[model samples]
Target chain A: MEKIPILRMGDFLLVTIQVDMHDRLAMALQDDLTQKISETSARGVLIDISSLEIVDSFIGRMLGNIAAMSRVLDAQTVVVGMRPAVAITLVELGMSLPGVRTALNVDAGMELLRESLNGHEGIRHGSNF
Target chain B: MAVISSETIPVTSEPDIVFVRRRVRETAAQIGLSLVDQTKVVTAASELARNTLIYGGGGAMQLESLNGPRLGVRLTFSDNGPGIPDIQLALRDGFTTGSGLGLGLGGTKRLVNEFAIESKVGQGTKIIITRWK
Candidate 1:
């Protein structure tokens, strides 16, 4: 019954993960995010994990899946505000989230998303699979 | 070596995994583990808890605070599900039976000071990991 809300800002969707997410919640967010992407035709997504203290391989994989899914749906995803400890642990866990983009904070993440959307718009549109 | 405190938590569903992590983190901190060590143990607990639920088909986790020559925390995860067929293969990185990244078992081993596992097909699996302060 508990759900993570997805907020829309112009052509982008912002998700701030404040809670320590469980498996079901992560999966639910995946479904809801992709559906929202399709419905809103969003150009980018920014996931802020500032408040998350722990991120294991499961959550790491979920972030990767979200990035891959967003790419397929013609959107870019930037995961921001990862704690240094979480980053070190993730690398040690052997999950680098290869496809997911990351930034230091929300503002930086938004800038990266906007830059990618505008500069590489033509290339991404043409390389659609 | 003596156990200062111990608690058993059931891992039946997704929310249970989160609870296990929180409890493990608190225990790790109480044992005087450094911030990095706390994160490592907590991350290891999260991985093992999820494995117990998803791969082992639900189980329980036992948390122990140790007071010996050194203070530490020990976690034991046990499941009565269909056991692993090959532990060596399972311990190798990038080998997964489920949709995960296959980092649970191997990575968890690396995060702790002591790691042990016992499993028998059709029986169950039990994993114990300890981190010293």
Candidate 2:
């Protein structure tokens, strides 16, 4: 069974989706991230999709699920490094990934995550749902 | 339109969805589709491939590289599962019989240059989409 690895940083969980993940792999990452968050008590989560070529509604929804689940687990979720073409296609596909935070790159994503965990709950962006 | 190249890939499992996306991208790129067009068609293929597996109980993806008045790529997803009862309703966003975002059919339509779908209850379902270069 193939699995996407989850790395635990100081106070955050990092996931770099470097492959074109199948549906099951995406779901597994969602489950694993939530469980890792609970176990590590991470304050934030960053998923770098820079290498992902496309994000259909299914993967888009998985991101939303991960974000929502992490919020319930007291962690912030930020998806970074989305290609411009993927963003265009995703929007045209009518999926905005509600409840999911995004950043331009890993550095900015980590910064946003840090801010969210720095007692600035007001800075939380994404998702009115 | 004539098919300059054609290939069929089985869509019986989840990993097959990824293959469909990759193959679509490769064909679309080979046909000189812009990066944006390749992304659009590939994304659309991913959505439909998942539908073939989960809703249609497994099928196959047929890719056709076309050269008739234009260069393009055409993808067909066919499955012999319980077909959709209401295509109009199913085409609406936020409507799904399964645990998905309900963007499989409708959203896929928006990502391609041409879209056609046929379904028969208890028979099967087939979806064809094309993107011109």
Candidate 3:
């Protein structure tokens, strides 16, 4: 069985969740990781779902939840390396991670997170849960 | 109707995840989506089918060819049993009231093109999702 990989980079957390694009584990891991963000008071979250072959509604919702939760924790969340299929799925599900950041790869995601943290008037608290 | 095609899978105590995914993938492929898109559709269908068996106690999935170049698939899972009273809560991750991962509805909702849900307390739920190719 494939395992979800997680790495901590200083105050930032990086999670590599391998998903079939349709498995519940994708969303579950996201949920679990989001909680960690809150508990740790991390400055940023980088979720890499590159191995995911699919992206469904449940996963999208969970991702949105993570982003929202991170905001509540005064942290930023960035979802990186989403496949085209995943993007289409998110569009179809009518799900949008409005305030959350997205990038083509981890490097871009990290750059975005760093910018978010370094920028003045950067932190804002919000939740739709 | 020449344009309307449908297939039904009976729900047993334990549904076949692979079979469900295969069927969804085939249907998605017919719509001219790339391999990646087909995978997404299959994945989304798996989550929904699992829910139908686990939460709904059983249901059916139907695929339909929509207007324009994009093809659409709609799955309606129903059970003559108790329904979800708290839709929002049910959609929340880790809010499952039963065993298994709590990513069913919320995750399934994110997999399709358009999603609509109708349910009543003590009744059942009918989720309709359409995906464009």
Candidate 4:
């Protein structure tokens, strides 16, 4: 598998994991995100987990941690491009990531990030919209 | 700020873990929380479930959903297994008493909007975490 890559995109930091599943990558991703969130104080973060095929408990928690860290930094975080298969595992494993925002694709996720930065009030509403 | 709703689920072991995670997400989704919010809630549930299995000696998970304007999910995993003797030690990263990578409590704490932990030597452990939607 390709190594996970972290990139800075404007106001949002994008972290891409090449791993097929959520594994110890959760911890590694957490560390990388925390450092970026702390140093730049970016208003938003987009974790591109599109490459991931599965999400286990550990990776789910790690994603959750990124959201929490972003909150602490006064920045918002969004998880973009998760495969449906991964979502199924997450649901099956009984892991809920309530604090993080997820978008079907990077564009949608980026749009949400912009909305968050624009001070949109209703963004906190559930995922159906 | 206050707990809105709480429920206790008793089941065999791993199977029940999935139930709690789904229920919390469903409730959060019903409240209009975003996908990101659902992920946080579910991730927190997974942590608690794993702990319940590994440390709690297979007991039950107490799930709390806080609503009204700002929504949040609070969950507690209580097991009569071997209690965590040192709360601080257990909270540290890379400190797993089990086969896990040791991200159970610490990672769960990071996943929620609000977090609290309590445990006794022989009794059990109670982890209270709230993730706002």
Tell me, by lDDT, which candidate is best: 1
* lDDT for model 4: 0.70
Per-residue lDDT tens digits for candidate 3, residues A1-129, read 444666788778998876453344555576667777767667889988887766554566677778888887778889999888667666554555566689999999999888877773423443211
Q: Estimate the overall C-alpha local distance difference test score of candidate 2.
A: 0.89
Off by over 4 Å in 3: A1-3, A21-28, A38-40, A120-129, B1-19, B26-33, B36-40, B50-55, B59-133
Q: What is the overall TM-score of model 4 with all chains considered together?
A: 0.52
Q: What pairs collide in candidate 1? A: none
- What's the TM-score of candidate 3 when only chain A is evaluated? 0.78
Ranking by lDDT: 1, 2, 4, 3
The TM-score that candidate 3 achieves is 0.60
- Predictions in order: lDDT: 0.90, 0.89, 0.69, 0.70
Q: Where in model 1 is the C-alpha error above 4 Å? A: A121-129, B98-104
Per-residue lDDT of candidate 4, residues B20-126 (tens digit): 76687777777666676676567667667767776677878777667655776667767787788888887775467647534535655665678787788888777
How well does candidate 2 score on lDDT at residue B26? Answer: 88
Candidate 2 interface RMSD after superposing interface residues = 1.2
**Across all candidates, what is each one's fraction of true contacts kept?**
0.67, 0.93, 0.33, 0.02
The DockQ values of the predictions, listed in order, are: 0.64, 0.73, 0.17, 0.04
Q: What class would a CAPRI assessor give candidate 3's docking?
A: incorrect
- Candidate with the larger lDDT of 1 and 3: 1
What does the interface RMSD come to for each candidate?
1.4, 1.2, 5.4, 8.2
Structural similarity to truth (TM-score) of each candidate:
0.94, 0.94, 0.60, 0.52
